[model samples]
Target: MVTKVVVVVVVVVVVVVVEVVVVVVVLVVVVVAVVVVTAAAAGELVKVEVVVVVVVVVVVVVVVVVVVVVVVVVVVVVVVEI
Candidate 1:
């Protein structure tokens, strides 16, 4: 009876230890994956920011050119009337 009790205790301890180790390993893997995903997302955001900046700059330049042409045309009309 004592021998059987001892065997049962040993088995329970082994299962508990194995369960703890598996939980720890799973936690570590989840942390690593989260870090990788965050880094990748940050890299993609930087790429998007660069594209947005380029687009904004181009739009500003085009607007400036259009405004200047309009002003020149107005000035010509005013001068011709005078």
Candidate 2:
């Protein structure tokens, strides 16, 4: 009877240990995956922000050029009329 009890206890302990190891490994993998995915998302956001900034800058430059050209043309026309 004592031998049977000992065998049962050993089996229980072994099973518990295996379960703990499996849980730890799964947690570690989940944490790593989250970190990697977050980093990739952050990188993509930075790229998008950069593209937006470049586009805004280009638009502002074009607007300024158009305004300057209109003013110059008006002044030349007025001088020619005078």
Candidate 3:
């Protein structure tokens, strides 16, 4: 029973980590593409400011997501151990 539980938890954690990484990568790519396109279409100075703002927001969001994921993984591991 313990082995099974451990295996399941490991699998779940691996999947979650992979999913989070993929999501963050996709979001970054999309955000960069959008920023670049918008900057090209709009005024340079205005769009540069907007891009900077968006990049910062994205960074914050990614950090939050990573922290949340880490917390969840730790909780799961602790629960499984118990």
The runs of at least 3 residues in candidate 1 whose Cα sits more than 4 Å from the true structure, single-residue gaps closed, are 43-82
Residue-level lDDT of model 2, residues 1-82, one tens digit each, is 5665566557556655665565566556655665676588875533545545655665566556556655665565557556
Q: Write the per-residue lDDT of candidate 3 for residues 1-82, one digit (tens) a residue.
A: 7796778778777867886787778687967787678678676444567667877887787778767877877787778677
2 against 3, candidate with superior lDDT: 3
Write candidate 1's Cα lDDT for 1-82 as tens digits. Answer: 5665566557556655665565566556655665676588875533545545655665566556556655665565557556
Q: Quick one: best lDDT, which candidate?
A: 3
Model 1 lDDT at residue 69: 53
Name the regions of candidate 3 deviating beyond 4 angstroms.
Answer: 1-9, 12-20, 27-46
Off by over 4 Å in 2: 43-82
> Each candidate's TM vs. the true structure?
0.51, 0.51, 0.58
Backbone clashes under 3 angstroms, per model: 0, 0, 0
lDDT of 2 at 35: 60
